[model samples]
Every structure is written in structure tokens, then in C-alpha cells.
Target: MSRTIRALAIVLGLTMLVAGCGSSSGDSASSSASSDGKFTVGFIYVGPKDDFGYNQAAYEASVAMEKAVPGVKVLQAENVPETAESEATMQNMIDKGAKVIFATSYGHYEFAKNMAEKNPGVTFVHQGGLKGDTKLDNLGTYFGTVYEPVYLAGIAAGSVTKSDKLGYVYAFPIPQTLANINAFTLGAQSVKPGIKVITIATGSWCDPSVQSQSVKTLLDQDVDVITQHQDCTKTIIEATEAAGAYSIGYHADASSLAPKGWVTGSEWNWTPLYTDIVKTVKDGTFKGSKYDGDFRVGLQTGDNPFVQSKYGSMVTDDTKALIEKAKKSFEDGGSPFAGPVEDQDGKVIYAKGKQPTYAEVETMKFFVKGVVGKIG
Candidate 1:
């Protein structure tokens, strides 16, 4: 589709563009963010900036990049749902002279992909979404080895879990979340044999009422520790703490909210990567740049952009040592889902001495052997 045609569709859809600090108001005044002038970058989020979860981390990174790059401006629109509204937001930013756009939600990929095709002059990068067969120069996906820290947190969960049952409250059965749940389960199993993890899918990234009910169900099942792959996590963590269960977090730290039941969690530090992308785009090097494809950083890459939080008081020094040892191994090129891994049906998945590549891991479709849930 042509850019002009797409713009007309957006206008007819009556989609609204949020105007904020550093934002545009649908006026066609020439953009300072043009390639030759003051570069402007746009970021659209799927939730409130202060959710203290996924969006918060991305929002903070956007602000950091804005400051890191001198003479560059940033446009931010929060609370952007994953629907066609996202397409409108992209068009608005493009009109405002944004040469690079960060679509910071998984569900935003389709719209971002469409926009990337329509606007070859602009660069679009997405977070946590897999790159499809369309090999566009201006489109890419980037993420950290998020499952690495989750595995570390799982070690803590396993160390302290009294009933050998760890509960996972996740957004979906997608490979990324599946990898986290599998890593968490495997990490716990490494510490405590015969450990079992119960999995429940909330299906929505930031639903509180559904998360609260999942916690109650897990608590009733005598699960002692709970962790999640959800976006807005306060409801689940707070619910877990209220029920006297240990909680592990994702996206951002909720340690303050679960003082008594808090375990160490994983968080995003996107400065290095985000800044690098902005610089590349601003320099007109984004087309053939390293960020031009499925860019993933892990321990071996030296900075995964995701790391573990400080350990809770309940974690033992011995457990911390073990986590560090595993981390070192990962830095030396070990994977959480290493060889000898099996599916829930006892069928071998990754045979001994054979490992799954990052590509294989990204398409993960089965529950690990000890997980107690169905993935469809």
C-alpha cells in the first residue's frame, strides 16, 4: 500500500493520535527529525508509562536515548492499544518527520511491519516479536536473552519452594513466554529434583482480575512460589504476597510491593541497544546495520539488556553462588534449555550433547517434561 493511501485510511478510520510533549498534532509542518536535520525518534507503548512492567522499562529507555543523543528529539505516545490505532500512531509520527520508530509491544509488530513496507525511508524496530519471511531492510526485531534471568530467578524459587510446586502465571503460550516458563521450571529442577511447575495462562498481558484469580488458584493448589511472564505484574505479585507465597517478577522489579515474599526478578536495561539503534538510524546506517534483522543479545554477547535484580533476604548465599556459577557457564556459551531436554510426554527434545539453536528456541511449542499445563 502507498503511504498516501494508508494515510487516507487512517483518516477515514477516525483514529486519534495522542499529542504529548515532543509530539505532533496532525499538522504537516516540516519535521526537524528529517534525516538531514535534527533527528527525531518516535515511540508508542501498549500501556501506561508507569506500569512498572514492560512499558515502564521501554519508556525509561526511550527517555534515556533521547538524552543520550544530543540534538535529537523524542515523541512518545503511551496507552496505545495493539489494534489499528497503532497504525495511526505510526503514520502520525512519520508525518512529524520521525525517521525511526520503536514499536515497543509484541502485538504492534503487524502494524509496524505494514508501515515499514509503506515507508521505505523510515526505519521500524519492534521488541520481542519474531521476524517473519519478509526481509525488509528497515524492519527488525530485538530482545535480550530474557529466559536467562528467569532461570536464575527460578533457582531462587526452587531453593525456597516448600511444596516443590512453583506456579507460573503467564500472558500466553507463545515461544518467548514458553521459553521463560521452561527455563524457570528447568532452573528449579536443577536445584530440587522431582520439582513440578503448574502453568496458567491469563491470555492478556496486563489483566489484573484474571491475574488475581490465577494466584488464588495456585495458592489453593499449595504452590509455594509464583512467578510470571505477564506485563503489568503488581496484581499477581501482590496477590501472591497477600496469600503468603513467594513471588518472582518480570519486565520490572516489584520487590517493593512484595516485601515479605519477594524473590529476585529480571529487568530490562535497553540503553546500550536503544542508543545504538538510534545512532545507526540517525547516521543513515540502519539499512545495512546489525540491528537490521533478528538481533538478540545474551550473556555471551556481553550485554543481554536484561539482568537479574538484587537477591531477596530469603535467598541463601549458597544459592547465590550456584546462580553465579550458572551465569558464568552461560557467559561461556551455555543455554538454559541445554541437551537432554525432554517434552512432557517423556520424549527427548534436545538429545544429550545436542543443543537447540536460538532459532529453534524461538519457535518452541511444547511444555517441558515437568510442566503441568496444556499449550494449544
Candidate 2:
């Protein structure tokens, strides 16, 4: 039997070559390798494919792979967690004769790596994994530099917040979440010098109930604009729409969710990475190497996946032009965290006239100058 799950949140936005920033899908029926030479690939996602963001993006990539590469066999099961269930599901793929497996969640990292090692003949690619063990010779990992676009979304939020206060609904407090929050705060401060951002961590990635409450809480306090780093925009978009506030969305395009109040957002284009891996497998040149897809490969490049909706009439053409210029500048060696940074505790982290390096931005851990509340 096969099932579907949606994992991860997809941020949405426009196509500009900015410096920073950054599925599974499920299979319906079991199948064997293709009669032709193409190999069979299996994808495991942590959430439902219909979840409308992370899972959907990965599923879309698998579909695109099928369309682009004739005779390639692809199977998927959605909502498979990183717990014990992953071991069984991954084993099922191996037993079913999957030549390569793509585990598209952070939790699946160790599980997939272990299985890949146990089944040395099968190739595995785990997204967002950092593995130091040499036992996994068949495993590789890849992730995007998403902090770049999050900063850009912050710029939109910063420009649109009339109250100089912004709200964010976070899923977890890991390094990834912290980096995203920092990028957003920096973007807002680019336009409004001391914009205050309030953050609420719902702990779980796909809890609509809790996410909605967090957004509503912020709105009740008169937050004019909202942004989110959760897997779904159900809470952020719903609360913002109910309160008649603007929102910047993540993962996939959510402009339709808040048609009138939508601004730009951040996104990850999985197809470019997916296509490259599929091609590598086909060409027999694939190796177990870690890769970070970003502006260099046009993966997170143009306007196809990321788009800024012209929803708010208040969004000026000048603002759009400024965003374009900022993107260019960042790509041309400008850092998103360019100095005078402060945490939620009012202590200075990066001094004035100092800029963060790529490694520093990638490992970001603190709040910036204008975020209103603590990470918790």
C-alpha cells in the first residue's frame, strides 16, 4: 500500500538573483523498475502531498522528472515521518527495487543514511543533512541557501508595515529558523530603521490550530503585516485576511491565499536540484557529495517559482525597483547582515560598520536590532 504526506513549508516570492535565501511526495501504488534502462527512484516526504507547500514542491519535481525524462520510474509515499516508520518505508522502497531514494526531510537524514549504508547498491540523497560518518558511502545531501530570499521578504514586510511592527510564526528554534528570522528582520530594517518584529514559535511545523492562534494574537495586538516560516500559510494568511492586514508568504506561491494583501516572499525551487540529480544518475556520474543549490545554478534564480504579487495597491513601483536593486547588490558581494546587529536581549552582536560573512549568515543564531520579542 502507498500513501502521501506533506513535509516542510514552501516560501513564495519573485525572481531576482539575491545572495541569500533559500517534498516528498507519496506514491499511490507499488511498482518495479522500468523495462527500459532508466532507474527507479523513490521519494519520501514528511507531510501530505496536498499540504500545499513543501510536500507539493517535491511532488511537483517528481512529476516534472517523469515528464522530462522518459522511461524513468518514480515512486513516492507522503507523510512518512523520520521516526521508526521511516525505516520500514525506506526498506519497502529497497525491497521494491528502487535504484535511488530521495528523502526530503531533515528527520529522515539518519534513517536514510543508515539504510543507504546497509544497502550499498542503492543511492540515497537526503536534503538538509550534515553527516560526518564515512559509513554512508552511498548517501549525499543537498540544501539551498534560503536565507537570501527571506531577507528580501523582510524588506517587503519592512516597507509595508505601517505600525513599524511585524509578526512572524515560526515552527522551530533550530539554526535554520533563527537564520530565517534574522534575514527577515534585516530586510525590514533596511527600510524602517528600528522596526520591531514579534516572533511566536508554534513548535510543530504543521499545526494549523496553533499557528492560527499565534497569528491572531499578533493581529489582536494591531500588527499590520504578517509573515511566516511554517509549513503552511493557513494560519498567517487566514488571520491576516480576517484582520485585513498584509502578509508575506513562504514556500510555493501564497498570493492566491491573500489575494488583496499579498506581498513578496521566499521560496525553494526543488526541480533544478532534482533534475540535476536525476541527470547525474542517468549519466552514471553521480557521486555521494553534498551540494548547496543557490543563485549560481539558476535553481533559485528567475521568476518561474518565486513571484511577488502586486496585490497591495500601496506597493509602489519604486519599492519593486528598490527590491531589484537590493537583490543585485547582495549578489554583487553585499551581505544581508551588514552590521550593527542586536539580539532580543538588547546586547550588540555585530558592531556597527561590520558585515557578516557567508558562513556567519549560514550559522545565524540570534535576533537582530529590531525584532520585538524573544525566540520562544
Candidate 3:
């Protein structure tokens, strides 16, 4: 079933039977266990395995992890809801002999923590979630500095936009989403001064209908270029091909989806991250402190967590030069949230020689100037 339909079914008090629910006890002699007899690694996905967005990225990483580690067995449960069923899914994996579990969704935080507490033997890693006051020893959070690459994509969009008006289709109004929007605007403004960005919040993560309608709304407003911070490539494909506008993508390489107007986009190379995590678990170095495994990496690091896809043939040389220069600056510790930043209300949030801390940026609430939308 589609992710949106499954979510609605979950909310409507329906008991959805997941495949492979009552397979084996995971300790069976014929199970797919490594030769070294280590426990299995489990991954819980919030969407389908082929969504070509968030879930696909994680699934691809898991496949890479399996190949990297010899004799390793990786189990996965797709289309898992973020409600109580999340805890149940983890339990099912545990029953099937999974020892290290990764929950790849923000809403799975509480359920993951609960599972960790109940199954102290299992290690839990949550994407885009922190183990706050719960202080769970076996739960940690990890995410990439996606804003860095989004900034570079913004340069491409800025260089190509004819109307100087760009549109962004977003899933929610959280701090993470806001940071990307602000960074994209800042990156565009750095190249094409006074460029305006129009944003639309779909309020749902993977609804193609809502996303398509949002793109239509932006196109009607004369937005010549469109990008997104969403869980699907529907916006990029529909905007560039159907609406005849420039496009940028997220989560994965979507250049194929927008042949006509594909510029460049931010992609997550989760192979390195997943391989490192699995190695740590295999080598007995895995820990579960409140913040033990809280990790963040981007382009500057040797591990290519955040990357810019190959520029489409239509991208200009000037835009490529600008992106390369900005990337070098980021590698040298420069940030998009540097001083002289202003809020949507024209209030100077950062002075001429100041910037926000990492913690502050992670919880950013206000939109930067030059952005046209309310956080609803």
C-alpha cells in the first residue's frame, strides 16, 4: 500500500498485517545469519522501499551495509507507521533476532526510546531525533547537514531562474525544514541579489496529490524554478516536465525525473554512514548513552554525507563556478547563517559579525528575509 493510505489506515483504527509477521523465531538453524553467528541488524522504514525519496535512500544504504560487512544479515520492515505499531515492529524484529535497530523517521523517536528501554539488549538509532530527558542509554540520533548541499543547489537555481522567483514545496514547518529554506534563500541571494523564494507547506510528507497541487500553485504565481524538502520526487518531476519550470530535488538523484529543467540537487550518500555504524556494532564499540552516537556530517568531511548531484547539461559555467567557490568556503568552516541575517519581519537576528550556534540552528523557528511564506 502507499504510505499515505497506510498512515490513514493506521489512524482509522485498522489493524494492518505486515508481511513476514510470523515467520521464524529468528534463531532458527536455517535462518540467514552470518558465519560468525552475530545478531541481525534491523531497519524500520516510514515509507515504501521504492518511494525514490527518504525511504529509498535509507534502503539503499542498508543494502550497501550488507555488502560491506561479510556474513552480515540485515532485516527491514517497510511502511511502518510512527504510532504504537513502531514499538510493535521493533519487538517483532527483536523476536526475529535483531540486535541493532535503526528507525529512519522523526516521528519514531518516542516509540524507539520505548523499545530501547524495554529491550535494553538492542541498540537503537533514530534519524533526526534526540534522546532528550528520557536519557535512554541505548538510543542516539544522527542526521546530515543537508542545508550545506541545498545551498549549493540554490546557487544553481539562482543562476538559471529567469523570473528571480523560486518556489519550495515542503512537508512541514519544523526547524529542520526552516533551516533548509533559509539556507536556500541565502545561497540564492548571495549570487543573484534580492531573489525571492515562495514556499508552500503540504503538511504531509509523501502525498503526491498535495505535492502536485502545491507545485501548481507556485507555477501559477510565476515561479520559474521549483525545489523541495519533501519525501518524494513528484514536485521535481511535475514542475519541470509538466509545468515547464526549472527544478531541484532532494534525498536522491532526480535528474532523470526532470530531464528538461534539471539543474542540480542535494543527495544523501548514506553508504559511508551506514557502513561505519555497522562496523562499530560489529567491533563491540557501539554505545547507547543519551548522546553517545549523536553524529552529523556534511561535504567537508571525507565521508560524503551531503553531495550535489552532477550538474545537468543546461547548468551554466558561471553557476558551476559559484557553487564550487561556495563549497570551498563551507569546507573552510563558513556557514550560510553568518552575520547580517534578518528575519522575515526585517529584524536583525544576527549582527554584522555574528552567527548562530549549531544548537540554535538545529532549532531555528523564524524564516530569513527574502522568503515569502508563513510557517503554518
How many collisions per candidate?
Answer: 0, 33, 1
Number of residue pairs clashing in candidate 2, backbone atoms closer than 3 angstroms, sequence gap of 3 or more or interchain: 33
How does each model score on lDDT?
0.87, 0.72, 0.80
| Top-lDDT structure, candidate number | 1
Rank candidates by lDDT, best first: 1, 3, 2
Candidate 3, residues 120-192, lDDT tens digits: the string is 8888888877565566666777778878889888888888888999999888899999999999999999988
Candidate 1 residue-wise lDDT, 77-170, digit = tens: 7777788878888898888788889998889999999999999999999998878667899999998888899998889999999999999999
Model 2 alpha-carbon drift over 4 Å, by segment: 1-29, 132-137, 288-313, 346-363
TM-score of 1: 0.87
| Model 2 Cα lDDT, one tens digit per residue, 128-196 | 766544555567776665677777778888888889889888887877788888888888888887787
Clashing pairs in 3: 137-288
Predicted candidate 3, C-alpha RMSD:
6.1
Candidate 1: give the clashing pairs. none
As a TM-score, model 2 comes out at 0.82
